[model samples]
Target: MTVEPSVLSAVDAGVATLTLNRPKSINALDHPMVTAMDELLRGWAAERDVNAVVLVGAGERGLCAGGDIVAIHRDASALSGSNAGDDEAAACASALFWADEYRLNADIARYPKPYIAIMDGIVMGGGVGISAHANTRVVTDRTRLAMPEVGIGFVPDVGGTHLLARVPDNLGVYAGLTATHLSGADALALGLADHFVAADDLDAFLRTVGETGPADALAKYAQEPPESAVEGRRDWIRDAFAADTVAEIIERCRAVGTEEADKTAASIAAKSPTALAVTLRSLRDEKPTLAETLQREYRVSLRSLLHPDMAEGIRAQVIDKDRTPSWRHAEHRDVPTAEVDAYFAPLPDDLELTINAAPQEDSSV
Candidate 1:
């Protein structure tokens, strides 16, 4: 019996393409996958003949679902009967998984060659980490993107807050709390994707991009994105999410009194309360560099690993297949200000990532 590499790499015509291959799991990333990707990216970065790199995923379902949360559930569960939180290195596999994962995200942002991500389908969580940071990103009608950590009792990591922070107005804040699923046009309007290529045209672009180069290939096939739903409702999104607290944001969304606005309020209302509070605070950071934001995120991620909600969330959402999760806190308002602050506290023994900030922050994705 032979096993396939989780990540498949190929170089041709001065272009290298890497495909995330776990189609059955929607190419969900695990620690091994992250390591493989890091190695492939480094090797391609040094190869003079590899002019550009394109990232794609196998299977029709999506580019990648996210990290393998079921595995995280396993690790967190093992610590359920022990004291892993007090000592993070012993907490769970999640800490180690994220440590290397965050580094890969930082490197992708700083990659020397043109990094192109073909976000052809569902892109969420870790998927967003890999693709949204790319120099060139392509989205299609099938794309369904989001950073849904709040729902899983986890704060967004993998530099999600940095990317979310740049979305115009308060859309990023709105997205963080509610885990809004973004359409192709929605991603484009929010600056997450560079070009809109029909899902069908993807094959043609893939075949020619290695030789023609992404810019020219995009020029030949890109289309005007479909109208963005989020942009249409930006008036309320900006006004509601600009508030200092989640309670205020919810109230403002209710004040809008539209069907969509009501759903938005309810969506925010249903997420893990603790996750909501911390996620909002992260998004509201005055002005942190991508590296700084990531550093802060690591603190929160390790902090989250110790919390019961992390394991319970996984149990309810993934293991038990129950839609209902009894969160640590009852609601966003119940989450304490002091507790929220602790999620961002400086790590002891300098567990903070040592990556450098991005050269210049671009507000446009």
Candidate 2:
């Protein structure tokens, strides 16, 4: 089979393994990577040689860190201008990227065949969207899972909001607000993963079950996934994060007055305050299908690029390697509802996606 430069695909024993090969950048998804993966998934659906697919990362460091935000920032910067003509052209280009990225994420969700994601390290934000909803999600000892869009002055995308909405109680809101990283064990407990095992045993487990193995045997194999230091904290997380808003959840954590809550609160307070506010609101707002939620997220992202916090957050956290962002909006309440509503504004019909199933409207999982 002809291989794409960004992705390495190999079919062995009817199990197709697609490894995200950009280890240098922790397999961060670029436009080319997204396009390549989407195209290959389409082809895989038709290939008789491939019965199952294992999505793995090339290195020990990460599965996919997130999108190539550095490239995204550079593109946005290059397109910025004072002239109306330049501004319009830039906006058009940005919108197209968002639409395509959102569509690709949707395809992964509804893709045929049993999809297994070997999430080894630093799965967050867009990474979560890529793997969270898969049939079998395997987490290793090194796994650090989170939806950290809030830190970057963005609400969760890649269907994170939709998945978060389905999680019980207000945990989704808490996760979105804090962008907290869940250990492999916690991921299983939170329904984000199927099982937990030792990182060292992952290779043997994969080989034992092989690709296209029986469902029952696969479940047994998952029971041996990697283990990490973070475990036995679910009760506290569920209790502290049970409220519907960040402020409420913070207050609950404060009420606990333990070091863990204190630490979590402090960690959250360090992120973009505006993003935390919007994330909570987004979590509590509505239930949409993966596609609809992605569309909404795209709208938020498109507007966020123009917002001061996005560039400032990236500058502090990435470009400068500093952790301080001077946000344009300091408080969530200070952000107008109209601004959030503007993100959901009707796009041109041609831009609307019709591929995925419509979302069922329900708050409860």
Best by TM-score: 1
**Each prediction's Cα lDDT score?**
0.85, 0.70
Among all windows of 10 consecutive residues in model 2, the one with the lowest summed lDDT is 356-365
Best prediction by lDDT: 1
- lDDT for each residue of candidate 1 in 1-365, tens digit (9 for 90 to 100): 89998999999998899999999999999999999998888878777777899999999999989999988877666764457653654345787788788888988888888899999888999999999989899999999999999888889889999988888899888778889999999999988889999999999988879768888899888999889999999988998999988888999999999999999999988888888888988888876877777778888887777677878888888889787988878867788889888777777665665774332322232
Q: Compose the digit string of candidate 2's lDDT tens values, residues 1-365.
A: 96547788887787778888888888888777777777777777667666677888888788888888886666545433223232342356555665666777787777677788888888876678778877778887788998888787767888888887777755566667777787887677566887665677778766755743736445555565444333444567678776655656667777887887788777776677666766766677668767778777776666666555776777788899778787766653465666656555665555554454422222332
- For each of the candidates, the C-alpha root-mean-square deviation to the true structure, in angstroms, is 3.9, 5.5
Residue 71: error of model 1 in Å?
A: 1.5
Residue 228 displacement (Å), model 1 = 0.6
TM-score of each: 0.95, 0.85
How many clashes (backbone atoms < 3 Å, residues ≥3 apart in a chain or on different chains) does model 2 have? 7
lDDT of 2 at 48: 62
